[model samples]
Target: MLTIDITGAEVLGQQGFHRDGLSLSGGLIMDAPVGRAVDLTGFRVLPGIVDVHGDGFERHLAPRRGAMKQMAEGLVAAEAELAANGITTGVLAQFVSWEGGLRGMDFADQVFGAIRDTAGGLVTDLRPQLRFETHLLDDYAGLPARIAEWGVSYVVFNDHLPHARLAEGRKPPRLVGQALKAQRNPEVHFQMLLDLHARRAEVPAALDSLCATLADMGVQMGSHDDHTAEARAAWRARGVKVSEFPETLEAAEAADAAGDVVILGAPNLVRGGSHKGNVSALDVVSMGMADAVASDYHYPSPRRAALMLARSGVLDFAAAWALVSAGPARALGLRDRGVLQAGKRADLVALDAADRVAMTVSGGRVSYLSGDIAARLVA
Candidate 1:
């Protein structure tokens, strides 16, 4: 297709929503109209959702909790779902954790490799995030090299070791099933967890070294589910600048004080509180500390959360919507999309007056088009 003049829609432009038509040619937004036009009357155009942290792709990759034999097809299917949700760019947050099955390092290898090879051909930009277990001391030395080899730039540190249970010399609940899924001997896996717990005291130093090396390599780093000011401070010292879903007001406040990007789950925003009963995302947003809202597990929440924020009067439409688009793009240092301006990537979502996504375009390609708007564009 040549340059398309997207007319008669309330496009969220640099200055906010306007009826001025948008044009895209050569996979980028254009200053002026140059080709055929479509009247998207009663529709709203906004920057495509940039999912900062999401792992919903796991369903596509392992619907039954087992790896799909055809990884590439799974990724393509995942892209379709993303585009349908108005996600022009999605960060597939994969785990390299002690937990077995799809989250293990070996599966991370497969997932990252597939993303690197398959994402280039897809319309929706798929980014890879490595969620590493901070207490996995054995994996520290080669982590940077492995990240580079996997072509992944974003890494989040997490400590999900169930320390209290292990310290009590108890097997964590569902231990046997988890080990079975990972194809590990249950007793051996329990021993491994115990050993990892014993080394909890060493994580700080190990993370300090590993994160420094990753920072030197320009890899974006984040700390996950922080619960205290001290914990957030510790991560900041290690060059981790993004606090992913801080679990307390103290942690979120600490991150804000240190100039770190604080990401909250969109589900929390929609539900009015964290599902895990931690800090409320709305409370954090009300305090002006949240940098972005992400689709942590459900792909639809970012859009809904932004709309909800707008309706709740915490922010105007543009500002609320930016939480899903520009804010996330900024968190990942992606400058191409998020804002609908001339010379930027023409990534946007067109929604009906009812707020249903009618069409989605990524880099000038129509990744998704449906409803009456399809006829308008075609006609």
Candidate 2:
């Protein structure tokens, strides 16, 4: 057991911190009498960020064209980046697509193995959230088994190919460029995209089975890019309580009405636009349509996005912070984290005025401080 006091820090969304201290014991926070504490005057002490969706680790997975990095190295670098970005509990969105290339099943297996092995020792608390492409229905049967064995925290259904089918010839050149950069043959990719859409009749049955299996196993389920109220209703019926990146205002509203947690990308809020030409996150937040805002592919955006939303008057600090913190935590059913309450796990971050991470403490132990390792525990 260890005890330290963080005093004079502003606790976001709460009454200003008294000139007292926070105490940690047995890896859980305990209230103690106020005393002379380490003064953190002028700084904000927020609950550690709980990032439900981030794929920035992909940068390390495929650092360059035709180059494959080792999972251990990528995990180390990814953990460092997450800490620097103020993410304490990070759910890396590992895409196990049917693309049949570097971003496919083998890569997912390796990364998932690394995540399971390295999670306890990493600078940040790392969890694997599988981003499953529905067209990968051929592999769906085995996923529940794998998730049961591996213990994944979250699962999101990505139908990028469905949207691509909708775009077809009107597809932007940048998307094509991205495909090429990933070493995918354009014709083959286009054919597969078309084939996936043509096979839509098979999707609902496969997805229903998969969702039911995961629900029975107590795994969290999320639907991505829901475009219509009907689409949202269908997912809701399947026990998919999370709506990720709803593409239309109607979809978001419908999810809200259905008591689904609507998750938007933090990058969309920070950039003030969506990369895929969907509904803007700022608009969603202003309309009270968003429940959680994830980092998505950009690890640093959630904290900055929270501040940006506050400054833009879309939400007050408490409401904006909830999108990145407690909202996502509750969405995933994470019981012990995402808030700075007494008796909770002392997972927290110290942030400067610019919303940059200065220190990150995970599970009552300092894991990362700025650019250095604050605590090193080997698993």
Candidate 3:
């Protein structure tokens, strides 16, 4: 364990700014000093961002098609980027879906195995969130065991099928491109889709059964792209308490009403709206429907989004920062990190006057240090 004392930097916690600064020792925050004090003037210290869900690392893992031969190297690069952005804990969303290649079950096995094997070497606390496609009915029976084998605690159900076209008994567009990407013949892929669609009526029962088993195993569950309040309610009944990126305001509101955490994309806020023309995260934040915001496809968006919210007067600094820190931490049931306080995990980030990440400390270890901050620490 490492001990560090950061002084002169304004410490921001859930309550507000602490002028007295703070200290870290043995991987936890300390009330009294246990290490040499370093003056971090002209900086602000806040809890390191807790990203509940993010798939941005996909590019690092598979930057180009057929370019990835190993995951360990990619994961290392991903952690560097995460620490540079002040993310202490990140949930890497890996897919186990009908779509083959990177999103396929075979690839998922490689990812999960790499993560488990590389856990000891990781500086940042990286966890896996299995994004299981709901239509893979055959996988339902074995998923619980596979999740345990992979040491994954979080699972999110997603249905990426073109529901309107499928419901109309029509083949979804882009079948050839999708098949080529999945390394399958277009005709075979089309047949697979049709076969899966025909069993849609049986999906609900299978999903319910799987959710119950996961609940028994104490795995946290969530649903993605919920489109309706009724759909949100149905998911809630199956013990899926997290609503990730609800496509409609009504769905988000319903999640809140049921006391479920509503997660929105931080990029949506940074860009002012959803790229897909869905409900705006800014609007959801304003309506008090968003419980947390994630990086989504961008590693730096969480920090940028939080600062933007504060600068725009949508929320005060403390409240806005919470959307990325405490809010996501709590949503993911991570009680140990996300807030700056005595006895908590010493996962802290130091930002310069311009709000750029100058130093990041994860578990009391300096994972990233830059500019004058790095020079000062070295000296």
Candidate 4:
């Protein structure tokens, strides 16, 4: 691992920023100086981002039809994007949905396998999260075995079947587009969706069973797009403690009341509200109903969201940044990183005077470096 004594920068610690130098050696932060010293005078060093929920890697994993033949190389590229954005710990959310194409089981198999096999050669801690469609009752039986086989410990349940529209016997607005993406005939796809929707009554028991099985296997479980307190409670009863992007204040407050982790989308914060017309992340965070902010679908939103939150005076810099760092780390059950402390993994980002990501270091190894900071590290 690369070792260095970094001095003069505004290093963020448990309390706040300090001018005291930071040291790294053998993939761990050191209590004192080690190896060559580097003067990072005008920079601000912050803990590496730990994105607990993100599907942004989907683009890199399969940019277009037949675009990513070599999946491992694609993962490397994904890690590079993560490193560039100061994310050392990134959870690449893949779906086991009926949507097919990138979100289909076959593609998910390749993605989870590639992450398990390829991330060892990459710097970022690329973990896999399987987003399983809740209405897939038939697939629930073998879900645990498949999850273990894929080496995925984190699973989130999503129900995106357009239940209301289907129940009304209305053709979903995007039916044709969804069929094209899945490469199934439109009528066939509609029928398949209707079939899944018709079995909605059976989903609850199936999910309860699946979540119990996963919990026994020591897997982490979450629910996506929770819209009501009752829905949040239902998930909580299954030992699914993380609620990602609760679409209503009722759901978010329910999570808070139950001591469950509430994750809001960073993109929502960046956009000033939920683009989908749901509850605002800022509102939830302001009321202390949210615990973490995730990238959701955009890799850069977490960093921007934190900075914007700080500037808005909703929180101090440390607390706001923690939503992206320490907060997510806690949600992911990772204790070794997320903070700049001796004996912890040496994961940190150096921001220039302009707050640009000048460099990112993961496990004491330089993952991304650019601008004038590169010359200083080399000197």
Relative to the true structure, candidate 4 reaches a TM of 0.99
lDDT per residue as tens, model 2, 1-379 = 2356666677654432444556666667777733334656666778889998888888876687557666787788888888877788888888877555556787788789888887777657788888888887678878888886666868888876645534464443455665675568777666666666777789999888889888888888898899999999999998998999999999999999888999999999888899889999888888887878899888889999988887887777777788888888888788788777788888877776666787777877766665221221110
Question: What's the residue-level lDDT of 311 in candidate 4?
Answer: 88
Writing each residue's lDDT as its tens digit, candidate 4 over 132-241 gives 99987888888899999989989999988888899998889989998999899999999999999988889888888889999999999999999999999999999999
Candidate 2 shows a clash count of 0
Query: For model 2, which pairs clash?
Result: none
Best by TM-score: 4
TM-score each candidate. 0.98, 0.89, 0.98, 0.99
C-alpha positional error of residue 169 in candidate 1 after TM-score superposition, expressed in Å: 1.0
Error of 2 at 115 (Å): 0.6
**Per-residue error (Å), model 3, residue 300:** 0.5
lDDT of each residue in 244-318, candidate 1, tens digit only: 999999999999988999999999999988778999999999899988999999998999999999999998898
RMSD of each: 1.2, 3.8, 1.2, 0.9
Q: How does candidate 2 score on lDDT?
A: 0.78
Per-residue CA lDDT of model 3 for 227-279, tens digit only, reads 99999999999999999999989999999988999999999999999999999
Residue 360's lDDT within candidate 1 is 87
Error of 1 at 210 (Å): 0.7
Evaluated at residue 79, the lDDT of candidate 3 is: 94
